[model samples]
Target: MKRIPMEIKVLIAIFLAGVISVLWYVYDTKAKRRAEAAAPTPISQPIDP
Candidate 1:
């Protein structure tokens, strides 16, 4: 069995983290859009001075 170098391990970790973050951002945006679409619009009331 061979041991991997620290630099390669660090690079792999960074790459994986970047990929995960991108995926999370895409999913979060889609979820937010869906939630916004399902939510009802609020009616504004006239304020008397």
Candidate 2:
């Protein structure tokens, strides 16, 4: 059996990092939307000085 090269390993790591970041962004966006839906509505009022 032959050993793998360090450059290949580095490339694999970078690819994995990119995939992870994209997944995280998607998950965070969904969570934010859900939170906004669940949040209470603000009362309507006129501002006075």
Candidate 3:
């Protein structure tokens, strides 16, 4: 078995974090679009004094 150094481990961790963050952003944008599409607009009614 080969041993990995601390620097390589740290780089791998950082790379994984970046990939996860990008995926999350893509997912969040899709969710927001779907929610907005499904959401209804509000209407204002007139009130008499």
Candidate 4:
């Protein structure tokens, strides 16, 4: 059996991290949209110091 090189392993790890980040971002965005849609409307008010 041939062993894998360290550089290739590092590259694979980085690639996996990028893929995971993209998936998480998509899931988070969808969840945020759903939450926003389900939220109640807020009363109109102006911010005051």
TM-score of each: 0.77, 0.76, 0.78, 0.79
What is the per-residue lDDT of model 4 for residues 1-49, given as tens digits with 9 covering 90 to 100?
8999999999999999999999999999888778767867422344468
What residue pairs clash in candidate 3, if any at all? none
Lowest summed lDDT across 10 adjacent residues in model 1 is found at: 39-48
Deviation in Å, model 1, residue 36 alpha carbon? 0.7
Model 1 C-alpha lDDT per residue in residues 1-49, reported as the tens digit of each score: 8999999999999999999999999999888778767867522345469
Q: Candidates sorted by TM-score, descending order? A: 4, 3, 1, 2
Name the weakest run of 10 consecutive residues (lDDT summed) in model 4. 39-48
lDDT of each: 0.84, 0.83, 0.83, 0.84
For 1-49, candidate 3 gives per-residue lDDT tens digits of 8999999999999999999999999999888778767867422334458
Number of the predicted model whose TM-score against the real structure is largest: 4
Please give the TM-score that candidate 2 achieves against the real structure.
0.76
Q: What's model 4's TM-score? A: 0.79
Candidate 4: residue 22 lDDT (0-100): 100
Whole-structure CA lDDT of model 2: 0.83
Q: Which window of 10 residues has the lowest lDDT sum in candidate 2?
A: 39-48
- In model 1, the clashing pairs are none
RMSD of 2: 5.6
Cα deviation of 13 in candidate 2 (Å)?
0.1
Candidate 3 yields a Cα-based lDDT of: 0.83
Off by over 4 Å in 1: 42-49
